[model samples]
Target: MISMFVTDLDGTLLKNNRYITKEDKEALQLLNKKGVDITIATGRSDREVQAVFKELNITGHRISQNGTFTFSKYNENVFSQVFEEGTSLKLFDFLHAFDFPCLISNFDNIHYAKEIPMAQTLQSLFKTPLIYQQDLRNRIEQDFSTSKFMLLGETSELLSLEKKIISLFDTDVSTFLSADMCLDIVPKGADKRRALEALLNQTGIKKQATASIGDGFNDINMLAYTPHSYVMSSAEPKVKLHGKKTVQHVYEAVDDLFCHNLIL
Candidate 1:
């Protein structure tokens, strides 16, 4: 029987990167009743996840900010990482040259995009207000530690930027395409796989007893680690390659496991 279920929000759980679907809500509610632990692992920060959790009126463990932070169901911080002050400044300076909308996140998310459309798009996706600011560089220069940096632009443009980032800061930074137009650069060694490992250690849940589902490049490593893994059918073929199975929706996967008696 599966003892735990981990999911990515934007694509795998949340419909269209906004809100939870009724089918998924009921599926997770059923799982809660069945005593199967639920986890939401995403590139979103814990703060954003908190808003989502309140909206769903459900509590679950979170592996947020691409594993830069892990919080228990009780809200205890189990693992956290921040870019070094020096590294954060350097990364900001280097990335700011690009014309894409750049947003910085620490424990709190800050959206500072001159482009109204891009800001609106992200606001709708995450359902967060535009806490507009123009002095991000100043804040970093003043020794502000950051958790992650996200760039919004055309898919092709961001892909090129991702390659450049990997080549230049290969060892110090981890990059993922969270969405088609979203590229997230996080501290090296801070990723879903590492955070999931930490979560497993903290919970004492064996790897074999957990099931994971994702639909983005960011979720690839986590999916790879769980033998009982799933990916959304809507995921790109390249992203789908990591999962052991595929489902049309979150409920489908949950229902499949129940039908096969994988969950007790």
Candidate 2:
């Protein structure tokens, strides 16, 4: 009884870092017609996720900001988590000491601490526009809703920073490393699973009745919580280990769901 079909967008559903396959689009349409609710869960912001939704013609629930926020079909913000102003300022100052570029997201926009090569590369890759700020620390006092912070650099540098971040923030933040170079730091209390739980509470969907497919460290909690979980074959070994099953493509997961009634 798969009441909800939640999937991560980037490495899982979007092939080649750009688009979803025609076959997957059609399969999701059919699954929705069959009474299965489809949800897009990702580390993307609301605006970033909207681009994918527009491409897929999706107007369902969304778990965005890596679980910092959730939105209903009407584009209503049903759940959200934000950094306290003091914490935001503290983190901003701490991260600013690094020469590496940092990217911060308000609920509506993304700001870059500086115009470094890594930030420019990520801006091009994610295709999300950003406002470069030389004094990002000061901007944190402007009362904007700050949700997530990210740093992209060499893997070794990111790993070292990850350790430092954990030691400094302790349990105050959640960290995810992906693509070998990007580290995402969000509030510890929020995640894809937490947002999904909120959605389930509102919709009365049982955890076991949910199906999820993803291929990132941030997707681990959501994948582990659902009974029917699929990881992409291309995922990193660490990510693949957390999934109950693995599929080569999104269409394969859909085929298993609709063709074979594989909800278990």
Candidate 3:
């Protein structure tokens, strides 16, 4: 009954440097030909997702910004979640207190408080420019449409930050680890699960009829949202449990869904 497939980008579909492998491209084309819906769910933004689509020469729905934003196949806006009043300030208090390197992300742009080498390195990797705003707090206050706040650090440090974020905000905020090293924070109702639920509603696709594949901790909720979840072989052992099964690569997951008729 699977009619839709959602896959994460980094470390799952893209082999390296935002490049899609031949196997993945072929698998996606097969799915397209089979009249199955294919979408990408990632922590990246609209620009990054668009670039990925162009590189792969395929188009479908997109769940962007760790589920803060969703777009239709033809590049139409579906929905966007933004921080509530005073929420950004509260998060800024913690970011300022911890002296953590943070980024203020909107749908199409990333703004930084100041110039940081690590942020610059990420820019190089993303091939996207970072907007410098020395007074980011003021900027957030002026425009409350900020999608998510992200903190970058080592894996252990990010885990510690995750604990701090959860303890500080409790259920008032939603937080998860992305890329295995960064902490992505959003409001309580903004996450992959919520976004996917909304997408299913839009497409009239049942949860049981959808298959999801991902590798990062942020992807776990989306993986668990469906019965036919597949985690990549490169994922951590802890992440594997979220999915019904594991595949050596994204193409294998697709093949299982289409060729083998296997749900697990």
**Candidate 3 per-residue lDDT over residues 1-264, each given as its tens digit:** 778889898889876645788998888877877777888898888788878777767788899889999987866677788887587888877786776678878766988785677665677767467888888788778864788888887879878878888888876678878786678887777877788888888888899889999998889889988988999888888899899989978888887775667433
**TM-score per model over all chains:** 0.95, 0.93, 0.92
Worst 10 residues of 2 by lDDT: 118-127
Residues 132-155, candidate 1, lDDT per residue (tens digit)?
667777887775678899898899
Model 2 misplaced stretches (Cα beyond 4 Å): 118-120, 262-264
Per-residue alpha-carbon lDDT of candidate 2 for residues 109-213, written as tens digits (9 for 90 to 100): 888876777555566667478888877777788876689998878878988988998898976888887444678888888899999999888788899888999
lDDT of each: 0.86, 0.82, 0.81
Candidate 2 RMSD to the correct structure: 1.9
How should the candidates be ordered by lDDT, best one leading?
1, 2, 3
Regions of model 1 farther than 4 Å from truth:
113-117
Report the alpha-carbon TM-score of model 3 versus the true structure: 0.92
CA-only RMSD, every prediction: 1.5, 1.9, 2.2
- Model 1 TM-score (2 dp): 0.95
Error of model 2, residue 260, in angstroms: 2.9
